[model samples]
Target: MFPFYFGYFDPTYIMLIPAILFSLYAQSRISSTFSRYLQVRSYKGITGAEAARIILDRNGLYDVPIEVIRGHLTDHYDPSRKVLRLSEDVYYGNSIASIGVAAHEAGHALQHQSGYAPLSIRNSLVPVVNIGSNLSWVFIILGFFMGFSAFINLGIWLFSGAVIFQLITLPVEYNASSRAIKQLEENYIIDDDEVRGARKVLDAAALTYVAATLMAVSQLLRLLIITRDSRD
Candidate 1:
């Protein structure tokens, strides 16, 4: 069963090598760009927390709180509790990258407050996507090995949720960056020249997500190929 499903463990299935290399390249580029932006201090020298506060205030969302979390680039917005959590570096750093990231999270808060449809759909899919991502691969592998076509199809359906989730995430991220850039310009958080750096940082980061989704799609395609070859 295993041999039939996995093509006798051929070394040539190593196309994954290129995919891995691309993923690493994307991650490194994003990190490097963000680090460079982090070194360029904003003209206002406003810390990330302060930047977030000002953005929220501008949008009339004064009650949403900002907290410093302990991680590198592990910042996110919590819609359930209405909080913007930033990494320690971003929370206190007075850098273009820091302010951009802070405002991005604040943008999520604004989206939540403004009833953004994409964000709302993303929030709704979180639980289903989480469960599907965990179970899909296991079912696909097991079903392929055991020659259970039903299980293979079920796995495909489940994995589709993850793909959809990744696709949906793109707009949420892009819109947040848009909001951040506009806020930065309007509030004078960064000058027109400096805004280009912020855009680069955010754009590089967005590419990582794009890379991830492509990887997932690639894997699913590989699985389909394997399943087709096995049937013969």
Candidate 2:
């Protein structure tokens, strides 16, 4: 009975079903959308790296260097190092998807330069969230095994910090995507017809973050339910 209470068979597992489904759909959607746009070349015929450079320079982020890395959808901006890293496809390819992704990373660089509030807050929470994320499962498992309610509560609190981090990240990512689209359009990097393709790519990418946040919230709710059951 005790094993059943803490195992996958636990009724509380049902809470995660919807989140898991949504996450799968989000992942699939992003992949298909990105792949589709990746085949559609931008009319401007500018490589992704060039697009990023142009956008960065337009915003006076000339000091931020762009580097190319190998992988799919691995592009990101490193605020700590003040560098922009783009995946192979995004850095070298001239597709609408490539340009959109490159500009998105540049937008993150812009966010760092301007000290965007959400990005700043998310950055500040990194260390704490890292610690909490790593230790949370340990405490939760130990508490359940030892029948210690205090430990369970501590684990829940730590996990809550991670949830807050995810919540803050939503705005940061959304703002970056918005900045990317606006810059791409205003500068004529992507024309009106191409804007739809770029938007689809960015919006699909944003859904991934939404899926992540939903998954986290669902897990937190499940933990709370388990704690309540333990008390009962």
Best by lDDT, which number? 2
Judged by TM-score, which candidate is best? 2
**Local distance difference test, candidate 2:** 0.91
What digit string (tens of lDDT, one per residue) describes model 1 on residues 148-218? 98888888889888888888899999999999999989988778998898889888888888888877776
Off by over 4 Å in 2: 1-8
- Evaluate residue 135 in candidate 1 and report its C-alpha lDDT on the 0 to 100 scale: 91
Relative to the unseen true structure, what is the C-alpha lDDT of residue 17 in candidate 2, on a scale of 0 to 100? 87
lDDT per residue (tens digit) for residues 1-232 in model 2: 1225644578777778899899999999999999999999988799999999999999998999999998889999988999999999999999999999999999999899898999999999999999998898888888998998888889889999999999999999999999999999888887999988988999999999999999899999988987887788
The local distance difference test score of each candidate is 0.86, 0.91
TM-score on alpha carbons, each prediction: 0.92, 0.96
List candidate 1 segments past 4 Å from native. 1-18
